[model samples]
Target chain A: MPAPTAEQEQAIRDAVVRGFDDQVRFLQELVATPSRRTDEADAQRLMARAFEDAGLTVDWLYGRGAGDMKGGLVANLFAYKALRAAGLLPEGRVHLQSVPEEECTGNGTLSVMQHGYTADAVVISEPMGEALVRAHLGVIWFDVDITGTAAHAQEMSRGFNALDAAFALIVRLRELEQHWNEITVGDEHFGDQEHPINLNVGVLEAGEWPSSVFDRCHFSVRVVVPPSLGSQRAWEQIEQCVEEAREQDPVVSRGHATVSRSGFFSDRYVLQPGSEAEGLLRELFSDVAGRELEAFATPAYIDSRVYGNYQDVPSLVFGPVAESLHGKDERVNLESVKRCTEIYALYMARWCGVREG
Target chain B: MPAPTAEQEQAIRDAVVRGFDDQVRFLQELVATPSRRTDEADAQRLMARAFEDAGLTVDWLYGRGAGDMKGGLVANLFAYKALRAAGLLPEGRVHLQSVPEEECTGNGTLSVMQHGYTADAVVISEPMGEALVRAHLGVIWFDVDITGTAAHAQEMSRGFNALDAAFALIVRLRELEQHWNEITVGDEHFGDQEHPINLNVGVLEAGEWPSSVFDRCHFSVRVVVPPSLGSQRAWEQIEQCVEEAREQDPVVSRGHATVSRSGFFSDRYVLQPGSEAEGLLRELFSDVAGRELEAFATPAYIDSRVYGNYQDVPSLVFGPVAESLHGKDERVNLESVKRCTEIYALYMARWCGVREG
Candidate 1:
């Protein structure tokens, strides 16, 4: 495939610079609209309108998601518009997808693939700090329930304390996290990154009365399972870790512990290097940003696995710099958004063999 | 005081044996009525009715209390009736008092003393398994609040996990409990008892979301302070323990911790032996139960502290052989209740110098 002409490339860059303000406004409107899980209708309408205005046929995929992905979704529209503003039309086909459940289950994208929407290659704007995501770790969300006996505080020894057992078990699981972090044999992508596997004790609830020993405890945790260990084996290790705590730890030994998968049982995906999609994005990012493209693995979950792992397509994940995702004052840098839009426009143009519009 | 004559004793014993059915019925009525904290009006009505039926001049002490005290309250009314049934009248005035807040603040008893209800000696039925309470531990209830920054679990290091810090601090407090338990120098009453100082993590609540690092945690604990250590010094030790945790534990160092008293800041009290009250109860218990009276220190809070510690009265805490106090199916042995009723009648008859009717 031939690259876009210098004039067309210059036109695409200039159009992105001109459309940057509107792109930010679109993103602002998206952020203003509440799109938490199971409440995405209004935001979905905005996304469909944006995709249609960019001259792409929009398919209404149904599911639940949060608004953090709206920045990337808006960037996709402006990138497509940059191509059209440059008077270029791709000779090959392109599909614009706005998926929900990317923050939770990745089921929206799975539904799209199930609905027979297949592409030769894929590009996702995932807010990766202007860097390409070579791989992402799998996430396994689990809940632990521990039951003990409640006695008056005067005789706390007569009754086992569930919170004590819970903390002991959590300490043991942290050791498992450390052990996984130490294992570097199959960690080709995430080996250099320190502490890639995190065992986060996210929520804990225990007991009811303040005068009695705690009798019951329930806690939820998110564990990052390395791609090499896989989700099944990773869960087995977690179960084994809990079993060891139950058998060994004195406090945990006295209580009853039960574990269950709570959410996000998704596997990791690696965008294998040297694919045509990767070679094109590498060239385009370097050309557009005037620097060498950097690629690294992410320790978080991403929706690229729907295509890259399950659908056997080269799904490229590259996007703008984002700070505080799912946190306080979460935001995207508009300048990085513009640079990513230029690169995305040129990559599409080159991969699809653009002709004069 | 001279012992009740054999004929008077047999008549008093027979009255208690005969009225055991009515006494149990009165206790049942009290149990059926809901009297939790501020909801004590209905139960108070039943107590007043029983006192009136037993022919005692009752003073309505308005306050809140639980049904656990109803057994002892019923015992008091029935013992007075036993004296009347035995055709005996006390030469000295006896105040049959029922007050609330015994389970929590001890304020109800405090109000009684504040109302100028002074006595020669005091006797309280605290469901002590047929054993006389020589001393009882103090109870201090406190709440701990911890706050941390919430971040995406992938970058958990950027956020301090409050649950982690809370568990770490609890572990440190448990060590302080152990240290206090090991200090035998001042634990004279509880010297032979193992783990006399109990620190119970009663209620723990932390975090809201399952995928984000926990940002906040709030927990309530019940700590038993020995009589010798005193409530003031015990609280100081707890504060010092928390301060050490904040300064030494790495996880606790990053989060903010706040401690405040929630309830039950009462000091321990020892029933000083050699008092006229102790000599009478010991002889009566040995004669009524046909066994040498057993006395031991209790690691629990009792309302006797109100009169024993504050009012300078010999507050004797002895009651029926009750099992599961403040627990499921909480009940007192009826046969033991009969024995205790006989002893209480004899003690009041002998102490108040009963005259033949």
Candidate 2:
């Protein structure tokens, strides 16, 4: 396939520069309002308000009937053709005509089914960064628990030590990682790919007192699995690994130890390479930014997975450079955000096909 | 030694019965007050008042010099003529014109220098049925800490599970017991002796969060090194055992897996047997109660070791029997308490050379 024409690139830059100010303002507003994964209602409100203000009809999608979607942060927004009619949108002055609509459509999923317009293409406006417009990784989280026995410090020999028990499992768990390193031999779309596997044991609790004989403990875990290893495969491997770990526990002969199975999950994602949407978004971002855009895979996941997975939509991650979104002093570069908004507007106009569907 | 004549036996029995009545009132007063070892001031006051009231010459001794003594409890009580002169005691009771006064001596090394008393012969005067007395086994407390790594739960392979690490150590510690059981051949205290060893791991803690990787864990280990095995040998063995446990941790190769050293120092003691004092007390009780004087051993430790070690004072363990002293609804029967007091008084008088001491 041939690359984009010079004219197409210039138009993208013009549109992005024109739409810079309003786009940056919108991003700032979104980040200012916390949007934790589980804060579905509040997040929806923020997204709906912002999209509607940008001259698009906002449709919210709830995750109802979603079996055990505990860790998912959800709500969908569908903005239609009319957004381009404002002309100000493509030029990035989209915020000039926003009507303040106060009522909440509490039923997000149902509202999406009813109010969503039939468009050739869809955009999921999440906080996902523009950095990973092509390929993004999945997130996985789990909980581990270790239990021992309680005993008085003076008579340590009489009781089994839970802290020791927890440490034993943890050591083996680390060994497992090294073991995986020795065996994992390939790549995913994201990198030189021996599948980007990052594991973080973030939180920990063992004995209650500093000098106490701990009988139980709990720890939280987080991981970003790469697409090289299929999502389902990775999950199964982790669970199996935990079971195999139990076999190493010396205390198992006398009593049982608890290892938790829930809390946080990550799945890898691989967008089909050299797809139709890739060229389309590339032309738009390049034109808007007045520079060659380097497309990369996302480090974390976003709502784009919902569209890419469920509706078979060719969704790419793009938003304000969201580096500091969940942290203290969160900020987005004004130039990048404005460029992203203009690209979004141009994609809607070109990709949506101007026919009455 | 020949058996005593019938009149001598009858006289001894009558004297013990009389002593029992007076002792019941005394024991109730002493036991009713909460005299935990840590509550030294109150315990001292209660002791001093009781000793002086009993008409014994008193002298106070403090480990840190003297007279930080919050309570007026007599440190040492004696009925010797020289010590009691010049109206030293109340009512000249120390003179003992006919019926000699019994003096209760407070052990400075115990219930003073130490946190609590681990005695061979402790007359708590706590309400007990028939002034029950028995020998007690030695006790030791322990505190152990285990450290592990924190990583993403999904990447548990890469993370160190502190809980697991601690758990593993605990298991090793348990295994060490079995090793001890096997290797401790010809250990008369344990060889084929049921419950030759007792261990209790009492407390456990790790990360504060449920899903965190356990960074640090602590558990209390209560192992009773048999009086036969000895604390010196036990401590050496335990130190080596924990050191060996480091081999199981992954981080140990990278750095210290936080294999720490702590002293939950053991206060192992053995009962003093076949002493003149014990024989007299046993005889007195058996005569009064009309039953073979019962002797038994307990898992708990007492202050008898101080006397047996430092002063070479022969010691015996005797206290009121109760369901639980530290648990809920803790109370002793009034009658039992009274019996304990009388027994203590009779024994004290007899052992102190009553009028001669």
Which candidate has the top score in lDDT? 1
TM-score per prediction, in order, is 0.80, 0.51
Name the candidate that leads on DockQ: 1
- Model 2 lDDT tens row, B1-112: 2233444333433544444444434433444454533444554465556565654211211121011111101112221211233122221132111100001113344434
True-vs-predicted CA distance for residue A71, candidate 1, Å: 3.5
Name the runs in model 2 displaced over 4 angstroms: A1-357, B1-111, B114-121, B124-150, B154-159, B163-184, B188-201, B208-215, B218-220, B223-251, B259-263, B284-307, B310-315, B320-357
Candidate 1 per-residue C-alpha lDDT over A48-105 given as tens digits, one digit per residue, 9 for 90 to 100: 8877777531111111111246777877888888888878888888798987777666
Runs in model 1 deviating more than 4 A are A1-70, A73-104, A111-121, A279-288, A329-331, A337-357, B1-104, B111-121, B283-287, B324-357
DockQ for model 1 equals: 0.47
Candidate 2 to native Cα RMSD, angstroms: 12.6
| Lowest-sum lDDT 10-residue window in model 1 chain A | A57-66
For candidate 2, what TM-score does chain B get against the true chain B? 0.63
- Compute the lDDT of residue B201 as modeled in candidate 2: 55
Q: How do the residues B22-117 of candidate 1 rate in per-residue lDDT, one tens digit apiece?
A: 777666667778776687787778787767766532111111112246667778788989999888887777888888767667788888889998
**Given candidate 1, what's the lDDT at residue A173?**
92
The residue pairs in collision within model 1 are none
